[model samples]
Target: MRQNPARRNALLDAAIEVLADEGSRGLTLRAVDQRAGVPTGTTSNYFSNRADLLEQLMRRVRERLTPDPAALAETLRATPSRDLVKTLMHQLVDRTRRERSSHLALLELRLEATRRPELDPTLTRFFTSDLDANVAFHLEAGLPGDRGSVLLLYLGMLGLIVDDLTVPEVLRPHGVDALVDSLVDRVFPPADHHGEEVVGQG
Candidate 1:
């Protein structure tokens, strides 16, 4: 396999676009090569097969969707309250919107996983780890919610992202931001008189 990190990532990024535009069925090695504007067989040089390509693509999607560390640190500096959760959720929605192709490619990969049993385990592990990390972060951040709250928020945001990408018209009635605010308000526990305590401050 090729060992050029930049080239490999470029191929995976191209694959993401192909998956988004053509769905799993159309994601042939040749298609990735063409989308990437590289020589024929370039993708094959990097990825051994369709499954290998898919596994890499899944990882790339996570990398592309990960929160900006600087922004996250800035947000973490504030008191963790319903408002903070709202801010986090809004940032998530914005990131999804900005990386529309990555999100759509993720949806395609999910559907493909259902048909390919071999792919399911890898996909499941990736999603499970992400959920676990989110739950851990919520707890450590002193966010205004328990595990159930985090789970509900995750489900709600997943639905919202799917709608926003696939059928945005559905959310047009309420708008995405307003719906995010509602999700935070309804899913998280209300702040007490003193407000939610900061993560480390007395």
Candidate 2:
């Protein structure tokens, strides 16, 4: 049982690894402590119970899984708007590929959230806030899409990432980059030459 933030984060990372490999059924406090290579009952020192551990795990995963706004800003600043969308989508694909275990654990938490009604409020707030921030980001960047369109793009990316990560063959043939390009073209509709309206053939 350590009060250190580093130790706490280490435990959470261990929990993610457990969840990714063994699913929620195997995410016991003892299991987490063992996975973290800490003393027995150490998880209980930080997390009061299973629910608390899960809630904190969700928060931690959200923090790690989301895109980096500052980096995205720098990227968008250097690239054309149409290309920025592709770049961001490619980032999503890259993250899913590189962080497969974390993403899988995130999916496990999502399923657990469905069973634990008490988690809804916290999860809801997290998702709502994230969506609002994303919408604001797109608008601030002068992207050619309203919040609804932005949201669609978000969902599309999520679905693509999940499918590609879980079942790579489905997307490997066309390539994630090409699929993302098509998706961005469909949802974003690149700006016209005259800067009046979107003008891209789907």
Against the reference, the lDDT scores of all candidates come to: 0.90, 0.84
**lDDT score at residue 20, model 2, on the 0-100 scale:** 95
Residue pairs in clash, model 1? none
TM-score of predicted model 1? 0.92
Provide the TM-score for each candidate, comma-separated.
0.92, 0.88
Residues 113-158, model 2: lDDT tens digits: 7988787787777678878988897888786678888998999988
Which number leads on TM-score? 1
Q: In candidate 2, where is summed lDDT lowest over 10 consecutive residues?
A: 191-200
The number of the candidate with the highest lDDT is: 1
Stretches off by above 4 angstroms in model 2 are 66-70, 191-200
lDDT of 1 by residue, 30-108 (tens): 9999999999999999999998899889889999999989989998898878888898988998899999999999888
**Cα-based lDDT at residue 44, candidate 2:** 93
